[model samples]
Target: MARLLYELCGIEDALRFSPFCWRIRYALAHKGLEAETRPWRFTEKEALAFARHDKVPVLVDGDEVVTDSYNIMRYLDHHYPEAPLLGEGMAETRARFFNHYAERTLAPAILRIIMKDLLCAIHPADRAYFRRNREKRLGCTLEAFHAPAQGLDQLNAALEPLRGQLKTSPFLDGQAPAGADYLLFGHFMWARCASNADLLAESDPVHDWHARMLDLHGGLGRNARRIRDVGAV
Candidate 1:
């Protein structure tokens, strides 16, 4: 059987927007491996019951089932060692840090800016579930929680460390893209695919790096369908 990847999508099946799923998608491309991607949505918990995970991305690799984006990356590297992604020694440790940073800091910041737009993009069947769950976690309604102006400021400030790193190198992992690159790139991809929010300024080095990432692995990110034009960086 072919490797199957369950990924989160929006209203249209083609609109694969989840940051975690994007990480695995890029990881698979980096390994030069292909998997048939299956679109999953917020209300489709039953579809993923076999994986025993509430969230994506779920990777079905023969008899091995992998959940979580970071684990999926590790699994790919372990199984396909020809092109190492997590790097070696201290580099691996740094990638781990990037993974955490993406989940904790970057994802939240972007979500604040694009949550409203995201709601519009997701499947109609998922809106209620998405809103209920998100509002409960956020302690406010989606409209009250979304603050693009504040979100933009927070996002830029939170990106200072990454901005400093990009000043010296083109990618998070020095000259070439790696796990660290994908970790953060997935967040940006989240905003790109779901919202028209202009998250990055043209002068920002991070914007340039994002463009580079989109062009990587045969334009895997660049070619993906988005809800609307995210506007120029």
Candidate 2:
């Protein structure tokens, strides 16, 4: 029985841009674990029927099946406790807050900045599905949704809390990188892979933390295939 992870990819199989999936990718690396990743497109919901979920970041570990990024993180930490991700007590609670912050605050800001580029980066077959669903949810077309200038401002504002925290410590989770670090890092990876826009200024502490994150786990995020690498951007 092999460990398998189904993650979302773009036009090219190597161009994985989903922030949720990236969280699991970093989590697996942090645990010193490896799983064969299968590239899944937006329109390939049927492929995940076995997991009873229509989303990426679905992990199949031996006889166990886990859906959703946060659940997968907890599953990995429980199964492989050697390198714990979600710490005990308050630490774990804080990590969960980071997860929500990434999903609710950070992700939307980044999406607003990169929606157009992301649309172009996704597979042609998924374009219609992506645009339709996103427009309905956002109540605006992709073109109208893209506001890099405003988005960047919103992104920076949303990151102020993290920036203040990082000012005192090197990583989000104190001395070492933990689940909280990965939670936020995933959103930045989404922006990096999908668009060429510069979301962070060089002087920001969050930007410095992001650089350190990219170099983690043998440069997993840094070496990931970007849209530009596939000539999508």
Candidate 3:
């Protein structure tokens, strides 16, 4: 059996905002890597505890600790060569690229739409602490994100070629959902958190496919105790 000591992450991240971590978690789940998740909330110092390079996605495999989301995904791909994250043909290749682009570029737009100022109405403490900290670290105030994000046009343009693929195929890669699905899933999930639940709720096949990914994984996500338990930490 593959050991359950796979990866670790932060909790409030999904809401507090960290697209990178969410991408890694979904990658792990999609591959069925059965890793232990250690969730660390970053209201303060916890974010740095496992960061080898001062980041959140610190993958702990037994005594080994790997940081960097891309590196983590690479490690999983290398270790579990079966059920490849990259699918088989040109279409699959395109889907993988689409996933990466959508996750990387379109993410900010989705976040801007989600984390809007309706915040003071709910989870004020968490919101306040996150804003203060991200500002200190990124060198900008939370208000920076308030400017009606400017990348959806780019996102829509990027996803244009695949708009047809998504409409025709049930999954991003057609019959089988590949690693790409999880990547995009993380984006949509984060959008939901940031409050743009309407994006996916719109007439997009991505929403239906995301629901299927959840079913394949057997739950909302790899919130395996190791990860979800960190909610309190």
lDDT of 3 at 132: 75
Ten contiguous residues minimizing lDDT sum, candidate 3: 1-10
TM-score of every candidate relative to the true structure: 0.95, 0.97, 0.67
How does each model score on lDDT?
0.89, 0.90, 0.56
Question: Which residue pairs show collisions in model 2?
Answer: none
| Candidate 2 structure, TM-score to reference | 0.97
- For model 1, how does the per-residue alpha-carbon lDDT over 1-233 read when each residue is reduced to its tens digit? 47999999877888889999999999999899999999999888999999898999999999999998988988898899877889668878778999999988887788889988898888889999998998998899999879888889889999999899999999988898889999889999999999989999999988999999999998999998998843322
lDDT of 3 by residue, 63-95 (tens): 666776656666777777677675446745665
lDDT of 1 at 191: 93
* lDDT (10s digit) by residue, model 2, range 94-125: 78999899989998899889988888888899
Local distance difference test, candidate 1: 0.89
Clashes (backbone N, CA, C under 3 Å), per candidate, total: 0, 0, 5
Candidates 2 and 3, the one with greater TM-score? 2
Clashing pairs in 3: 4-36, 37-226, 37-227, 38-226, 114-194
Per-residue lDDT value at 29 in model 3: 67
- Displacement of residue 227 (Cα, Å) in model 3 is 17
